[model samples]
Target: MTNQQDNIAALLQDMKSSVSEFEQTEDMGILQRIDADFQRFAQLVTLFLIAERDTYYGYFLMSMAFRTNYAVSTIAGIRLGEYPPVFETNPLILLKYSLKEILYIFCHEIDHVVFNHPAEMMKSNPEGNPELFELFNYAADASVNDMLNAEIKHGKKFMQAPKGVVTSKVIRNKFRLSHVQPLESYQYYFDLIKHHANMLGEPQQNGIAPIPSGSAENNASPNNNAIPGGVATSNAITAAGAAGNINDHAWTFATEHDEPASESAEAMAEAVKELLNEVDSMMDGEARGLMPARFSTAVARANKPPALNWKAILKKYVGTIAADKVKTRMRLNRRQPQRFDLSGTRESKTLKIVVAIDTSGSVSDKEIEQIFSEIFAIIARRSFELTVIECDEEIQRVYQLKSPKDLPNRVEGRGGTSFTPVIEYINKRRYFRDALLIYFTDGYGEASIPRPLTYRNLWVVLGNTSNLSVENPYGLALPLEE
Candidate 1:
């Protein structure tokens, strides 16, 4: 056998070893289907060997952990056989019904080696750059879709498409390599592999497919050398494991596998033992914080106050006083003060302001800082108890903003635009009467109505009037005129 075949065999063996550990009692049908698929793949390899006897190609098998599937990676090196390698008469078609698809996928992988696509893509793009990979995946997916659509339209069996017809046209048309930097060169190939995996039934661990790195620099090795999520390592691999054991923060498993069947079973008893030890260590930190007479350190820090002027303090006090006066005048004799009211309380009813902030890519850091400052100022002046809910495709984070300081240290998330989460959040937390939901966002979000919640919602749009027509059903969307 050639060196390429030898490597391929070794890769297959390693994958089998890894997958053997998974308790396969439940998915017998799936396992049988996979075995059939492998048999088909093996036949294709036999044909490739007969056609090109001495060609320098390297093949490796990968066990797709998430989908419980298998895949092969073939790399072409030095040509050991003659050019335009002749095919055997009785070539075994791996996927009999979709020969064209199988061929396209095969050629796509081979092109990675032939064109040095991985290295080219890496040199042109930065490591872990999602945008570059996204562009590449879309391009490849579009090309594959176009072919699929054409086959359906022509009523031609896709398998009938002739071999060796693969072209780099899609890759070229999709990404402008000339304009790209060297660091990004790896992304195109990575995207190609990732998209190919998706096209195949076997997907990768994170719903996000991984792009294989061309060089050692591009290798998509795990950040921490770890086994598959299901298999136990030095520790448990679950979010509960993370919460119980702080050191297990890096441990990540699929959502379905988050709660294991036998968390306290004898087989997994070792994990529970180690997890308890880690929990003890974490609790020690909190235990120290709760120690009585811990106020001395805090008092020492408070004694040395940073320089502050009466003018600044006066401005702050005036705003607080003015807000308090407005509240008192509005409900002078109508409402009685509750027992919880203090002498310096700013408002009779705490302002339940729902601060909805935009987290789209268009929002700049400076803009964020400025907007946060304004929100903080308003919250501080009005002494408003805030419930800041941020959304962008959905409500990514919901933070309780009892103090103005929370505005500065809030979590940031950015992506697609949707306003449903904001409305949904408001509707859910309807107990806050006299609650005003103030949303600070670019008016590019979709219109969404707040469900029958007890809270009053308001949208404070942060963008030019040109895009002000975006509808909001929950409350009046007041756009900030630039």
Candidate 2:
């Protein structure tokens, strides 16, 4: 095994153990700074992250928990799947906050994954609006804080959402949502906030705001957008005004965390995805039934993965896609037995294909249907092992199609917009070096500067995005008319 594999295996073993038992090699200074009691709290949450995903204890099995450094005052996300679970923590948080509050933070972190707030925010704001991100954190916290099933110490409640955060009651008051369900998904709250904001005549650029859409908040960027450090812009103060006691609880969850190394994060994410898929396999019947109806669907979807197999999506560009070989009648067969005819040397070539699809939110079903029909017409003349990829900003899924019927009935990701992910994905799959890459997208995303045209690339754009002026140094970018 290579160094990467060895490290990951070691990490997994550490994750499977209790936080107390797990070793601390790197962050000795920080760990030493944190109190032992807080370490126990971290261990409890870490164990929860890697808890045995069985029926009786299956509540957290679907939750993707990680034991990473809580460098800032908070913690969350997938990087915690590694060995020797390290829950993010700092001196002040451990000293000041109670275990019950820590539990609340833990539940809040998991809620982000369960509701997929990050992705939804990405879908809502593909441009990466900082204001919206802040709002999302607060709004998400509000939505999650009360919904958790945790109760710590003498029946005291775990969650105590700060006054700055908005709650369901806030939504009820703002939009007169008297009938809004008790346990609405985070998206519901986000939508409610967005719809209300638009009604108030705020700029609806991307058509959504943070918990309310933070990008629009005037106080969003204090350093650049403000007068040096003060809340100079109207947006900043606007954001601050919304936060009842904004300055007090300014620490956001998404921001407080560190950026994991891209390669390791992606690598671990895939591994965790597989492990979650396996755990999900056994989560049928009563175990499944126990989860909240709304929360259950997300896990169910993750586990079952839509039953739409493009040979298990090539079971990640992970399959061999055959293409019709360009052929000409020759007089000889060199490998087996020479076809002796005083004609020409005989040769056989196996062809392959690469198809990259833009599954960005803007691309419609009709677009998928229309584009695929025309593509099928083009490649139908030959026996090609087709590979299909559904992507948005990043590749959401990948699979190899054995036949035309192998077309997937469903797709993943309507989140944001990016083409670089597929480009990078293609670069790694060096084996398909000579395949014809037929890409389908809305033509609304970033592309490589000096385009990597190692493989023949073709872009089939749908909608008005076809009008977009894209400089293609590699191959053709044509509008799919009709």
Clashes of each: 17, 31
Per-residue CA lDDT of candidate 1, range 291-401, in tens? 222122322333344444322332343343322222333332334445324232234434555566767655666665666566566556455666666677777787776
How many pairs in model 1 have backbone atoms within 3 A of each other, for residues 3 or more apart or on separate chains, i.e. clashes? 17
Q: Give the best candidate by lDDT.
A: 2
Q: Flag regions of model 2 displaced more than 4 Å.
A: 1-37, 44-86, 149-165, 172-181, 195-296, 306-482
Report how far off residue 257 is in candidate 1 (Å): 73
Q: 1-482 in candidate 2: lDDT tens per residue?
A: 33433443344334323222312222233333334444444445444433322222223433333332322322223333343212343222222223334445555555555555544555555454545554454456556654653222224342343222345665566456665554566666666565444333232111111222221332231231222221111222122112222212222223245543333333433443454445456566756565455455655554553332222222222233433333344544445345564344433244467777767676676666655565556555555556777888677888887554566665788887777777677777775676767777777665443355444666666655344445653665655553
TM-score of each: 0.27, 0.38
Model 2 C-alpha lDDT versus the unseen true structure: 0.46
Residue 183 lDDT in candidate 2 = 53
Instruction: Candidate 1: list runs displaced more than 4 Å.
Output: 1-347, 402-404, 408-410, 451-456, 466-469, 472-474
